[model samples]
Target: MRRHRSSREIAAAVFFAGLACATLGGMGQRCLPVAVVGHLCVDLAPRLREAAVLEPGRLFDVGPLGVSLGGCVANTGSRLLELGVDAHLAATVGDDDLAEVVRAAALRSFGERVTLDVEPGAGTSYSVVVEPPGQDRTFWHHSGANDAFTGGTLPPGDVVHVGYPSLLPGLLAKDGTPLLDLLRRASARGSTTSLDLAVVDEKSAAGQRDWADLFARVLPLVDVLSPSLDDLLSALRIDPGTTPRLDLADELAGRLLGWGAAVAVVSAGAEGLVVRTAGRERLERAGSALAPRAEAWAGRRFRRPVIAPRRIVSTNGAGDAATAGLLAAVAAGADPETAALVAVTVAATVIAGDRVTPTLLEDLVTPAPTTPSAPGDPAAGAAPSAPLLLPANQPRGRFYRGGAAIGAFRGTGAAEEFTPEDWVGSVTCVRGEPGIGETSLPDGVRLRDAVAADPEGWLGAAHVAAFGADTKLLVKLLDAGQRLPVHAHPHDDFAQTHCGTAHGKAEAWYILSPGEVWLGLARDLDAETLGRLVTEQDIDTLLGAMHRIPVAAGDRVYVPPGVLHAIGQGILLAEVQEPEDLSILLEWRDFELDGATDGHLDLGFPLALSAVEHSARSREQVEALLTRADDPGPGLPVAAEEYFRLDRHDVRGSAELEAGFAILVVTEGPLEIGGVPAPAGSTLLVAAAAGGLTVRGNGELLACRPPVAR
Candidate 1:
């Protein structure tokens, strides 16, 4: 998909794009890149009026005829590169004038990374597509050089996608021997094989072949198979137009997976996309070269309609663009759900216009090389810089269960469960400001007062100079014994207008234990719907609008202010955020809190939802917010850096941290600071005057600090 940028923005973007291009160029041309190999065609699409009539052999004036790249290699492959994916195209085109046009476009768009086989005397495939408003499209198609693509020398990559195999006559010959041979060869060549289908003419040699038999043979070697509902029906020798759309797609997807295809993507034109992954056992064995990514794919099935684009226009290459998105994300190592979201979001752009300006899905992309480390023994690395280890400063909350996690850290009694959240070095508190839910330290020595007494000793001199003796950050060790309610936090503007507060809670999560969480709106939720849901206490309706994301230990989640979110059951996490507790809860049933009374922060439902973001965030956008649970170094998402800062200290022998007033949560390993043994399961304080704590032993800790002023 292309990105539309204004002149000034485009010029500025090109600088970064140039940098990205240069970096990607430095990598091997085929390294971890998506290799698209299949049919090549050019589509001539003419838009007709809603009431336009056409007679046989009649030519009339058309509204607008758009000429653009067509077929698998160009549509999907080219779009992949446009979306910032490392992709190389390999397709066969005829030795003709149209071939030169295709070749030039390919070379210009993809640079020298394109691999096209210009066969002398071969016909370049072309299609005359008639798109009339309020009517289905009819195609006058010719499969020329595409029919000659009989699994030619494919490029080397982790994943290889072969599109329109059904349109390639030579590949479908001999009971699909050619296609099987191609897939097998591609697999053996150290590449995971993917397949996409094309609409075949009923009378063509390609359609007359035994597709049912061919699918059995070819699917076993294919790792990913994506076909439209009609295409799947054609393969099954059934009329898809007469069958229920999602049912038929699901049926065919299941059959394809059963036939040993590790993943199945069923496209229902205009309706949406359904993706299913094989079982774990199958993923382990049938994933072929893609097994390393199986954990991200196995045993998942999700269907999503296209995300709404900024505008509605010709849907030419929407599916291909979406496929490009999936492949691009998968190639970049995103999980299945995240990849599917990227697909829908990308496709949304295709439907919206010729180019896509990225919104939410752009967050899924991080530089590939600095990938976070997989979860491991945290104590086996370098120590963080901070020196002092204070005791857990947990304040009681009705729904928190940090006692177990904190107990596990301190090696105390059988670690009874308590809903104690870590609130270290904080200058802000909801109850303290209201003089309710307030507690003091031993002998009425409040932690807030203690910090104020020695601002330079606890908070750094810089922190005191910048914002006075108060620390601006608050951290929590939250154990979600039950799912939290759907809720949102106001932003600074909203809080200032509604709550008389200086800051709003824009929180981020660093998962200490793996589980699921609900984040943002899965669909564009209108204020009426959200307000009604909250007023009526329609829990399902409220939650159904949100995206449920599965997370793992060490994952990072960025929750911007005004975005609705909920912590799922059985998740233990360290939450860092701006120092406030102004929550506007949407779903509070079956929990200890009273929705009618306490859920809305004393503000009525009508006014509270104003603090909620009503915009639609497709599943892809929500998944994009979850970082791949790999990075070990202070892995807070960049989106959250402005609200708060986090550092993951993997201590081996020693390490140094920047001098600051911060809360420390020890996640793993055995370690000590300033001769005090702070093992796993402690939330302590570090004095800024400590001037960077030096770790002496092996352990892992998280340092949570406030936002740096602009």
Candidate 2:
């Protein structure tokens, strides 16, 4: 009978298949796109007919109002497209007469880059600005569809700029929740955003409070916050009149940076603009034109003096134009200083025009060169550079080993030292042995044999011990007679099934002495010979088949599992192995001990025979051991994987082991760890948890640890 598949099995297969497809799909698609949001507005300005005398109840006649595009949506959006950016504008417009006009204008000007969403019954916004004379303009703004704008209208883009939130009352709702949500969505889509502060009606308490809280929530997400000096002063509640006599623009920029802007550019009227980034500020002045021949003859030629335009016609949209120029320059990859210059030039052009005349402004627009000026160039001026800080107590941009710097603070006279407290701990040892006898450590503490202590410290000390926990091989230092048997270990599967253990012994040895060793498959044994000898228990014949090589200090040899090998007498080494003890002894001849039951080896006969790699045991195929003549005795012998790395340090005279906790083993002369005396053959297990202390001693200290794996 056919049965239904279980939900668990079906889900598991589906999840793994989907994950693989997603990983492969992501590897093929990568690109960058930009999104611009905020509603578009039509600005209508009445042409000045006649100057009105200042008197009560007096009305002056004016020409018919002219309609034009306004807001950051029109300026920044159009400028980005003009600069050939892949920028898409997302905004809601009224589905009325004005909407048709606005859509037509945006489509004609922005080509396919403009995206307009029509909201029914919503009137398209239009501001009727009237400037009589010598006074700030009065705006008759009609907020139509923009009042209902929400985060749903914002499209994904590489960069999102919220032009004028003041026009949309919905943006200033409560905590400016809608605006914050839109900006957050853009950020989540990996877009860098900028928010331009709109004009606030500060006469009312509600208006002032709303703007203050709005900027607080807005500025944090903004990467480049370009606010006019006056707007910042209003938002920060700083009284410009009572502040200490200094460059207010520079001070405001500094305050904004401290408040968490990656970069801040403040436009300071006649004083030009101040650009601050990475804790350094620079002043970018307006560019001056060379004096005409007539002016030059009249001694009016100034020496590189930045001058505002000679005539002022219309100042209404000058700031917006300047912002457009700056954004355009940045989108085109201009530096902060160069972008500031371009912005000022654009502002100067606007002031020199009657209306927002694009043709005349373009004629007057002179952009700073794209190429960066060389250092010390007169045009670039001398700006203070931010100091480069280095890691702990070390000199800036310098490499260090011991007794070097740790952390460094730029502009502050503070640095930290790299010491033992900075590291986990160090390793140290005394004598040298290849595998069994020599004492070692995981980090700083001494390694003890399991049989030596009831509660073995080194056995379960590390997060993962070098050897298998169930293995029978006990690491020990032999001062007298102790020869290991010639044996091999079964594979994990075989050992688990027959020997009641889960691991097999695949071990390697690091020779720490000068001694000759016999290793590899039995001597005079081919595949057939070894197989026959293993079944017959011909211990002597098998031992004779193995190869014997002279191994010196700092030599390494690999002994794979199921390979019959043994450490010859007089050889000492450090052994790293899969922690397991099952061994199949193949040799038992000419020893002053019982050969049978009493002193016999457990072969795990059938299991070992099945798991043994006959090809790897050949004499010619066995790898020869490598030894280093010049050994840097255990301190931290480079990081390793097979458990730990061991380092050996040779110290002469009275040496300070710095102020830190370290395990000091007195292999030679007397040494002191943490000021406590440790004589020869004494193992001082220093506690790293105790913090830093002093280690003073006289002798060669061998520091051993697991080898660092690649």
Candidate 3:
């Protein structure tokens, strides 16, 4: 549920931040931006060998000291930007020389994107990190100005991240209200939020506090909660290295999830990490601000092995690297499995290096390893497909609470079953593939590879040549159980220039049920007004500005990028888009989101507001955009043909479907396609090579395919 800004968008935001754009300059042009709130301190590490003994009164000889900007502010924030996230930073620093060094490092790393509040005369906080070779390091830390960072004032972003509450006393005391209030504000503004923790010192003020009461009050406000094992153990006051420590960690993580965290991850050194999720319920709680896909996280319960670094240097900041990587992946629409692996891999890279640098962080942003073979391939130990039936990939999404519409298509009766089972979406996605929105094959086979192994058969030879083995389309059975937030997606140009991605979201919908919806703007509004209303959290004004439309069964709506829209509750539709799950939320109030922190995509309001189409639409414009189902014959309007296409076939007696890489959703039927016995509510992937597959039985189906150009 904790939505993260895409590394691409985050990097773009950082690009502007690094530039220190004075007035939303470059940021106004980007997508989702990320903001990190925490302590920006100096880390002075002095190395010592394990054999060295501490002398009570003697000044022992140690190696040369390594000085750099430490703490999550510099560590995580810098890495996220370096990894190409459009991100910014906010932290409190003392007005000392060390603060200047912190300032220099931050500016040099991310420019004005990082906001450092200098407390006059107060010395910057510092840490004396003592790392004895092969031994756990000890930290002698000074809270300094960091003790006062309660997120009192935060820069704008689509996702807001905070860390080291133990190091921020004012942020943690009184049941962490100040920090919690900030998080609530961020969610109200529609930002997906994340929280990180630091190891607590047994002798410090933090160690003396009652953690049990504090976490219960704060954890639920966070979408993503990642904490180190040491921190969790110390706060819970559990004996160290118990007989069943790993088991205890899992139990602890589950408790936090129960406390309200959507996704709970605990980092255990050497043993790696354990992640838990409540699936459907959690995704629903995240709301539409994040556009979270259910299958990517819901029902995901897994453990990952540590990616050992090439060698051990200092372990400091490695945890931050891990956290940054996972969030980046999540923001980029990468699956949960990929996110965890990337996190561990980045941590490994950090540990293996002498120090974290831009060059090193770049390596952390590489593509994840692809699957070896298609799922269910004989070599993979999964059963082979039975004739015309391909695996029915139905994954839940965070946008809705249940997928009754999707479930009905899959033959799951009246019970609106939703969870690991939410929406039946995607088949050979062209974009955001092998990352997020990809389908798994039989027995763990990946859809990408399955098609790659036989491109001509799966996708047409033309599609393979024009768009490679990947299908240039994505199809989904969307059930709007609730009204989606007023939002818009970026265009290809906007994405390339601001988000650094090849594709932007250009989608169309084929309504399967009746519901009210909002689209486009009723009248042109000045950019300043739009930005002001957004900043002021004027939900009524913003929603009223858009064109409201009443849609019913068989309505075909074309949703171009950069246009504001909201799918009214109770409408079920077959949705198709550019494959990437990228949305810029405009209204988050009354929804489960932090509009102030997440609505702007980290580029600030001015820049993000510019991407929206503020031009007024006439009644004709509205009518042209909406094509009644009765007027069309199995295809979308001209505005959408360039992106994707859809066709509805009501089968009865005998019918044959043309061959092409297509997804067939049984809207209403008890029929067979290409020899596959598909009943009503079943989804099947039909290969182009299947040529004109013979169909038998009476049924209705929605046939989906990529754009004509591909």
Query: Which prediction has the highest lDDT against the true structure?
Result: 3
Off by over 4 Å in 2: 1-34, 50-59, 83-86, 133-136, 203-213, 236-238, 242-246, 278-307, 310-313, 354-710
Task: Judging by TM-score against the true structure, name the best candidate.
Answer: 3
Tell me the tens digit of each residue's lDDT in model 2 across 1-710.
00123476466446534533332233221112345666568988887755544588878677777778877678666544433344567677888998989988887776545667678888998887776666556677777888766645544344566766766667667678777766654443334566666555566332567454555566666656676776666656667886632278777777665555555777765656777653211111100110001111111101111238668776666666677656554443344555566677666666787323223223332332322334422122211121100011111111111111111101111121111011111111111212322222211012333213212222232322433322222221221023455666676667677666645555555564557666765434455676667556686676666676767755666665666666665454545444454555554454332323222124434434556555434544554323244543333222223433334455575553421112333445455545554443333433222234344667654443333323
Weakest lDDT window of 10 consecutive positions for candidate 3? 413-422
Each candidate's number of clashing pairs is 21, 64, 41
When 2 and 3 are scored with lDDT, the better candidate is: 3
Per residue, candidate 1 scores C-alpha lDDT tens digits across 655-681 of: 777777677777775567655556566
- What do the candidate models score in CA lDDT, each in turn? 0.68, 0.48, 0.69
The better-scoring model by lDDT among 1 and 2 is 1
- Tell me the lDDT of model 2 at 38: 67
Prediction 3 TM-score vs. true: 0.49
Residue 514 of candidate 1: its Cα lDDT? 86
The whole-model C-alpha lDDT of candidate 2 against the native structure comes to 0.48
